[model samples]
Target chain A: MSAKQDNSPNRIDTKRLTLYALLVAAAMVFSYIESLVPLFFIAPGVKIGLANAVSLLLAAKGRYKGAFAVNISRILLSALLFGSAVSLVFSLSGGIVSLIVTVLLHKTKLFGIVGISIAGAVTHNLVQLAAAVLFFGGGVLYYAPVLVVSGIVCGLALGTLDFVIIKKIKTNL
Target chain B: MKWRDFYIIAAALLIAAVFLCLFPGSGGKTVTVKQNNETVYTGSLYTDKEVKLDGNTLVIKDGVCFMKSAECKNKVCVHTGKISKKGESIICLPNRIIAQIE
Candidate 1:
């Protein structure tokens, strides 16, 4: 089956649009829930990347455009609502880099959902660190070790979630 | 799912762990506090002291430093525990303060 069946600009398929809108809404809700969870005490800016799981699901289903759209819109909207301009920058950098890494890793098919999720998590932190260095200074890299550890652990948990969810939905999807 | 996938995850985790273990050793004994891109205080981690800045206080005791108090809402710095190694740091983003062992 083709990845995208609709090419006509004038024809707006309500069903596909509704599905994509639902996915975006789901991603936003996950992002909102994640913000509600107080994770700062654990590590500054560390998160479980719940919305990324949705993106992973889309990527696994070969809906790359949908995944990217959902992930990007989620980041922008969440940041605007729940964070500052600085946070918007941080999430944008991290989310974009993370999406790229997950997509590339998923394309390779050399790794499972767990591995792709791990890579995405780690890349998110690293890129956020880079953004920190760029915006803050080189001194921020000192947080790298902790971020790495947090990234791996959170990735493992979220990846397992993604695995189970993907497995359960595999037949229907 | 596959053996290779398991290996990939294991390897990634091993690398992260190895890095965590190795990084702390590279930190120096000097502790520096920075705010707004400026170094505010430089001291010895071995010397127990208290640093007060912009209503935030960092307490260093027994070679470990932690955010004793902060005005931030989350108090993440206060909850981030302590730092004693060279590379370890407690960052209070709300206050724009970073206490690092270097």
Candidate 2:
């Protein structure tokens, strides 16, 4: 067998690996910008979550492994730059939930990056609330109901943003 | 993923945003002590928005924004009970109302 044939295809291809690295760097830039941008006048915590758009693009492009790697790198980089350990908690909580949602939605014909954003937003809120309860206690959960409602709204908004950007990219390709 | 899908998603998001913008925080009674469509007093400034004044200072229990102890008069803002619902209000000594979830 040829030497190249002996190795597993799962091993990173240098060319594709480089491309994935570039995508990850771009995702980090977007994540940083997301932190800087103002979400709205209401809850200070909510945001458009634009960074996850990069992940959606990867998943849609059929680079599932590359997409997962991009996700891990982005989360680590974001937490490091932000200088907060607590954020790691929120990120982990949000990330796993989002991945699950994306995979499930991936099977649907109507679903797209828009669905991915909605999943990310909703999962982010759920994880954040769970963290709140664990650390701050139950009383603070009075804010729980409102947060859930807001989550759904924020999720759909971010989802729509993703949907538009993806559509624009697809047409030109 | 298609041209038509874009329009469908956009419309859905527009509706969701509109709904969220209009959602009230908690559902409580309105004090409604306005003069010319302007609200005057609305319970304590910070506590109503939050139970603790800041960073774990004061806590409201049994349904009210209470001062653990302070020199601020109009503790009458004290009368405003803990409100978690939208459109709820507590009138202060200045005839102001603390509106939440509006």
Write the residue-wise lDDT of candidate 2 on A1-173 in tens digits. 23465467566766777777888788888877876777766664666666676676666665666667888788888788774888887776777667656655665656656655555566666577678667654444445445555656666666667666776766311
Best by TM-score: 1
What stretches of model 1 exceed 4 Å from their correct place? Answer: A1-12, A170-173, B14-102
lDDT of 1 by residue, B1-102 (tens): 545666656666676677565444233277899998799988656556788889699987766889898997999999989878778999989889988887
Candidate lDDT values, in order: 0.78, 0.56
Q: For model 2, what is the error of residue A34's alpha carbon versus the real structure, in angstroms, after optimal superposition? A: 2.2
Which candidate tops lDDT?
1
**Where does the lowest 10-residue lDDT sum fall in candidate 2 chain B?**
B46-55
Candidate 2 ranges beyond 4 A from true positions: A1-9, A108-110, A149-154, A168-173, B1-62, B65-102
Rate residue A46 of model 1 by lDDT.
77
Interface RMSD for candidate number 1?
5.2
